[model samples]
Target: MSEALLDIRNLELRYGAAVAVRDISLQVHPGQLVAVIGNNGAGKSSMVRGATGLVRPSGGQVIFRGEDTTRLPANKKVARGLVMVPEGRLLFPGQTVEDNLILGAYVHGGIKTPRSKATLQRVLELFPRLRERLHQQAGSMSGGEQQMLAIARGLMAEPELLVIDELSLGLAPKIVDQLIGVLADLNRTGLTILLVEQLASYALAIAHTAYVVANGRISHHGPSAELARDPEVMEAFLGRKKTAA
Candidate 1:
């Protein structure tokens, strides 16, 4: 089997005295797409934040490429090729699309490497809509376009492990399908992806593995197909019997 790209063991996070994530443990192998599915406030976001070093875990460890990175700063993590496209499509609202994408390569520190340009071209190709809006202000784009821009920006980082939070937020189903298809293509090309999603069916369709989080802890972890068939996971995440297709 390919070596694990990322591992979280006994991870915990707290906001003041209230625990946000507790004892979460999971692994993502190279080129695997892993989805973490749960309802809002189920600690899914906290887990991603902890993994990306945005929130220091109160306990446990985050190991990346066999090295302990529990206490590493967020910027250091980005430099090491762990990138996150945060929820709510965080982008430079006033900046041009090209400017936002360039910022994603800031970890390389203005080196102007050929790799950066190649990566930019690749992203624009993957998201052709972004090509026409290269000079447009990011704030002027629709919600779906802004989300695409946010993800394309993260791709410019050339991450080995990409963590995406909520790819289907506030968009039409067709737009969500298009974005997820792009993400699926990325995963198939050997990029390890950790996706936090509320849409269980859509997420499971592309993921290799799935985990269900509830009340700040991981309640299920298994193959995506098996997890989709699992009554417990369906109840936890979807809150109803999955109708027969």
Candidate 2:
């Protein structure tokens, strides 16, 4: 296998004496879709923030493309091709959809360059609803449409590594399935992704490798298919009862 595109080593994070992540280490390689699945309060989002430089890690090394970027700010990471779609779809509520997309490319010079313009065209092709709502306020859309905008905005950054936090949060099952399909298609086209999702079955179904986080630690790591079939993992994270052998 090639060297990891994003390598996180012994990551420890805290919020004012409360340890959210403890000695967590992981890697995501080029073109691979990796899933981090856990119940609520497992610190999945915290770990992502540390990796992406949204929050400086209390302790750890975040290596991207072989450079130590542990202390870099979030914008710096985005400039270097690590972008995130945060939880809650954090769109500019009052801004037009086009404006939100333009803001996403701010680190890349705000869609003025030829390359950025081509990216915008591609993103619009992927999400036609966004094209239809280009002038519409982002907050005025339905939850599913908003989620589509969030992912489209993330793509506007032209990320080599897209880390999405909570892809299935609060959306209908049909909407979640559609987004998951979109992610799978993106990965097929060589986009590396790290998905942190609460719905274990949906995430595991799409990921090549899976990590099960519990109580701020990784309790299991393996191939996603195997993990999905493991009775223990299913019982714990998928809320399935084990039947008699």
Candidate 3:
């Protein structure tokens, strides 16, 4: 069996005295699309922050490619190929789309390098709409286009595991569908993904495995197909329960 690409063992995260995540553990192996689904305030975002080094974990280890990266900062993690398309599609609003993408390649000495230039071209091909608006102000676009650009920016880093938070945040259903298809295609081409999403149905559609997070803990986990069929999962999404299995 292939070794895991990312592993979080008994992760504990806190904000002052309040614990956000308690003993949460997860694993993403090579070439797998894994989803973590939960409602708002379920500690999903907090988990991503800890995993990607946006915030320090009070406990546990973040093992990436068999190396301990728990204490590394966000930039270091990005340099090591663990990139996140953050929540809220945080693009540089005043900058041109091309400028934003170039900034994403900063880890590789900007896009002036041949390898970085080729990667930028591939990213543009993946999101042709971005190519058309390369010179437009990033904030001038629609919500869906901005989200696409945010993802495209992350791609400029050439990540080994792409972690996306709240993919369907503020977009039409059709737009969300299109973006999800793009992610599926990326995964098919050997990109490992760990998607943290509130939309369980969409996330499960592309994931091989999934974990249902509740109250800062993993309440249930299994194949995405099975989780979708589970009554507990349905009820959790419907707000009928505080926990799921």
Candidate 4:
């Protein structure tokens, strides 16, 4: 495999005295869709926070594009081509959808350059719904549309690796399916992705590799297909698949 685009080695994270991530190491190589699946409070989000520089790690390292970025701020990571679409669709409620996209390009100085303008055009092409609602207030959109906007905004940054946290959160199964397809397509187009999703089945369906998190640690890591069929993992997380009686 090519050198990793994002590497988290022995990463530990804490909220004051409470440790959320414990010596967790993971990697996302170019053009691979890596999924991190776990139940709530399993430290999935915390690991993402630590890796993406939204929160500082209590221990270990975050290497991006072969550089040590452990203590860098979130904006700095964004500038380095490591972008994250946070768990919640944290859009500017009062701003137009266009404004939210402009903010995504803030690191590039807000779509002023020709390159940024081309990126904006590509994002709009990828999400036509966002294009139609460019003038609409971000908060006024439906849940799925808002999620689409969130992803579109992220693309405006032109990240080399896109880390999406809890993509299925607060979304209907149908919406999640649609977004999953979009992600799969993105991966096929050579965009590396680290998808942290609670819905194991959905993520595993699209991911090339998967890590199962339990109790703030990785309980399993393997190819998605093999892990999907692993009886223990299914029983532990997917709750025993039903068979036709």
CA RMSD (A), model 2: 1.9
Q: Model 4: what TM-score?
A: 0.96
Top-lDDT candidate index:
3
Clashing pairs in 3: none
Task: Give the Å error, residue 237, model 3.
Answer: 0.6
Candidate 2 C-alpha lDDT tens digits along 1-245: 99999999989999999999997889999999999988889999999999999888999899999999999999999999999999998999899999999999899899899989999999999999999999999999999999999999999999999999999888988999999999999999999999999888888889999898888889999999899888788877653324454
TM-score of every candidate: 0.96, 0.97, 0.96, 0.96
Worst 10 residues of 2 by lDDT: 236-245
Give one digit per residue, the lDDT tens place, for model 4 in 98-170. Answer: 9999999999988899999999998888888999999999999998999998898888899999999988889
**Against the true structure, candidate 3 has what lDDT?**
0.93
lDDT of 3 by residue, 78-168 (tens): 9999999999978999999999999999998999999999999999999999999999999999999999999999999999999999999
- After superposition, the stretches of candidate 1 with alpha carbons farther than 4 Å from their true spots are 238-245
lDDT per residue (tens digit) for residues 45-107 in model 1: 999999999999999999999899999999999999999999998899999999999999889
lDDT of each: 0.90, 0.92, 0.93, 0.90
- Between candidates 1 and 3, the one scoring higher on TM-score is 3
**Total backbone clashes of candidate 2, pairs 3 or more residues apart or in separate chains:** 0
